[model samples]
Target: MAELPKSVSIREVGPRDGLQNEDPIPTEAKVRLLDALSRTGVRRIEAVSFVHPRAIPQMADADEVWQRAAKVDGVRYSALVPNSKGAQRALAAGFTEIEVVVSASDTHNRRNVNRGTDESLDDIAELIDLLHQAGATAEVIIATSFGCPYEGDVDPARVAAIVDRAVRDGADRVAFGDTTGMGTPRRVRGLITAVRDRDADIPVLLHFHNTRGTALANLLTALELGVTEFDASVGGLGGCPYAPGASGNLATEEAVHMLHDMGIDTDIDLDALIEVAELAEELTGRRLPSGVLRAGPRTRLTASSG
Candidate 1:
């Protein structure tokens, strides 16, 4: 087995990505969730997205949520933007770390943002400039990097080309998203290799959904490939509004438990994270699909029969 990195950074996207698919919660609840996540020792949090209210009603209160959040001392917060307008809104909300997303598959891109792949890339190039002008860093997230529900198979070379374009347009970092959880170990390796072959210096983050039960396997493969940054949600709460049949994101507490057992450090409090996951279940009024939440962590013990 390839040696794993000593430590990794897990960005919690529960408050934003996780809640966007559920029924709209109160702005106060969003603020409370952000505050709770900040206290869980999660260093990075994707707090909100500045999209139009009609598009994602759950995120309609993005401005109020950010204004009311208890920004912690050591935790870095970021927000997602769909276009130049969204970027401006995020900047106005005092966000220094902003993420913009474009899809690798044209069909998915069209369905996601009502634009073709090339059109979104063109917009992203301009959006990157807009973000930089406001003294904020821009990270481009490539959705459906592995495979697309609409397009079926997404070529790795196509994903590489998108990454190349985003990097050339001055994106500080790039994230590969398994938009419909269509990633396996082989697909993850191919996509990472393709991206690295194009640009080895750009920071890479992996966002996986457990829709097909391959999220953790893909994470392990990325780890072996030296990809250290990842995005996870508390209580496995997330699904793309545009992608039908897509499930929740990889569970944060479950990932932390596996990483800790492997001697890899994520600096996240597993117990505290589980508590937050439970809170998420309570808030959503549904049992989330998290293995660690259901079966307990690996350290849990039971009495043996004599």
Candidate 2:
């Protein structure tokens, strides 16, 4: 059996990816979520995105939201962008760590950015150079890394090629997005192996969705493979807008609960996180899909009727 990591870093995406799919909430609500998440001991959060208002109206007020949200000390925040213009917006908003995305599947890539994957990568190379010049670190997130809803069964070599190119283009880090929750242990292992064969030391983050109930299992497989960073959303919020049947992301509290039970350190307060998840549910006015949030943690004891 492969060894599991002693600790893991969970980046909260509730403020950005989580809300991007929901109806546009008030900017105050967005700021409130950002502030609450920062207090949950999660060191990293994807605070917002810099996309055109017409593209994702939910993220239209990215600037005002980030400006009003209280930036806690010791917490590193990141923003997602779609293109050079979006990157400029994030930089202007003072985000040092920014993320851009491309899909491994050409069909999905076109659906996502309205352009081919190669074209987006070409732009990403220039975007990375621009970010570097501004003393910012660029992280390239490759969506549909496992399987595409339209094409199905993406080749591991294709994903590997994207990783190689992104790293070569000076991306400070890379993440594989399991868009539509199509990842399995076999797929995860194959993809990670292919990427590792080329570059053994580049930092990689995994983003999994719980649409098919395989998110946690996939996470365990990744842990066994020595991946320590992951992206999760509070209250299991958000999914890919263009990918049909894609559900919310893996719940942050659920992942943290499992890690803590296994004696793995995440440095997050489970109780506090649950509280914030409740807040998220209240803000969204809908029931989220987080099992831990619904059923509580495993350690909770009920009064016996004996």
Q: Which prediction has the highest TM-score against the true structure?
A: 2
Candidate 2 runs further than 4 Å off? 239-246
- lDDT per model, in order? 0.91, 0.92
Pairs that clash in candidate 1: none
Candidate 1, lDDT over the whole model: 0.91
> Which one wins on lDDT?
2
1-306: candidate 2 lDDT, tens digit per residue: 888899999999999999997777899999999999999899999999999999899999999999999999989999999888999899999999999999999999898778999999999999999999999999999999999989999999998899889999999999999988899999999999999999788899999998888999999999999999999999898855655445669999999999999889987899999999999999988788898999999999898997
What value does the lDDT take at residue 199 in candidate 2?
79
How much does candidate 2 score in TM-score?
0.97
Kindly list the per-residue Cα lDDT of model 1 for residues 155-214, writing each as its tens digit: 999999998999899999999998888899999999999989989999999999998899
